[model samples]
Target: MTSIPPTDFRSFLSSVGRVFAVFFRQGRKARRTRFFFLFSFLPVAVSLVIKFNQVFSGKPGREGGYLFTNLIMLFYLQMIILILALFYGTSVCSEELEGKTLAYLITRPIPKAAIVLGKYAAYMAVMTGMVILGLIFSFFVLNVDRLLDPSLYGLLGRYLGVLILGLMAYGAFFTFLGSSLKRSIFFGLLFSFGWENVIQYFPGSTQRLAIAHYLKSFLPATSSGRFSFLTFRLEPTKPGLALLMLFAIAAAFLALACLFFSKKEYSLED
Candidate 1:
């Protein structure tokens, strides 16, 4: 694409469109796609095995609801969601850099931040679709008996909204790490499973420092002992404030990622 006038709003959008188109098309072939595709089906596999035990005993009980909610939350919120966002988000820039393709993109006439925005949007699209499909299939497998329940669909929608929001907040923050750190996944793990997990247990307002604090506020408090750590000694932020804070966190990290990408001199060697 030729260089459009930098001040032209329509032209800038057109540039973003072109970058988004290129990235979205190629993103499917990424290894994360295949890995997460299997990872998403995990709950389905677990649900089937557990449910089958009940069936083989000729005692198909009402345990599906508890099993579904428990397994899904444990797998996705505690594990898959964070890992998905970590790998894909940090790879936003790192992938191109390691592949030595960043030069080709930077050489284009488009604004550098447009590269970040376009690629971020494209990755989000791919990740969201994959995770949701997994969530849906697992939901169906676990809750096949309740398919017609009106409230079940509403509950599904709530889970979808929360997962997507978590992806955005976590993905953007890790994208910043990708832009700034060569070994971002290490720190991503530390932050996601360590600080984010541990900080929520701290008393008073100090728990608010972790991103999980805001995301967990949107989820219902569970009574299960396994996940009591999530709700134990926690202060819930209002949903409105939590939503706003998540958006703010995403925006701030994304902005910094863009800024650093635009200013820093990255080399194929580095």
Candidate 2:
């Protein structure tokens, strides 16, 4: 049996810290890093349209309110988080490769896992920050009158938690694709809109295979449209099971990413 090296918490923490610094500096220097702006502001643009439509069409009272609020959650997941995660997540390793810095990082004493994880941590920071900001913006735009209501805060908290979980799950999967495949973004797009969106709508147990399926299961059933884009009823999974599945998906993909990044021979030409 291979003997594992003794664990050192201090060393691990130091490596993580170093990786964070490098990725953040790289992010700052990357001129094309408009993802932050695009992700942060796109929700505002959408909310403006929705707000106006709601004003003209009249308020969706009570149950309509539930559908509208939950639709925002679904829209945020499908549109904002899905696109942002695909673009940025798939760029985690590819960006380094493009800059020709990945080779240098590999040669250093830092563990490859640490580097992969560090980059993921940095990605999480930026993605989560933008998502939270977008959520707040959308909330205010759509619910300006309800903003001061104390009950809305609790609902916001729940939605934010689910959004973050969805981000982490999708982020890890796309990050893995970036590390493992040459043309990750193209495939990621196909999988996001093509596979995930389509599969989740399929009736019966097959829908459970998609990450979005589990996410939808976490939505409160107070609204008829909480988990469905159409009139088709959604199969509900236990909240605990859904949450567990999300964490599992995130952990599984992240592990694959680390393993692939540590072993692969990446070309710097891209």
For model 1, which pairs clash? none
Q: Which candidate is the best by TM-score?
A: 1
Per-residue CA lDDT of candidate 2, range 130-163, in tens?
7888777877787776777787778778888888
TM-score, every prediction: 0.92, 0.86
Q: Looking at model 2, how many pairs of residues clash?
A: 0
Report lDDT per candidate: 0.84, 0.78
Evaluated at residue 204, the lDDT of candidate 2 is 89
Model 2 residue runs over 4 Å out of place are: 1-9, 28-32, 49-71, 222-231
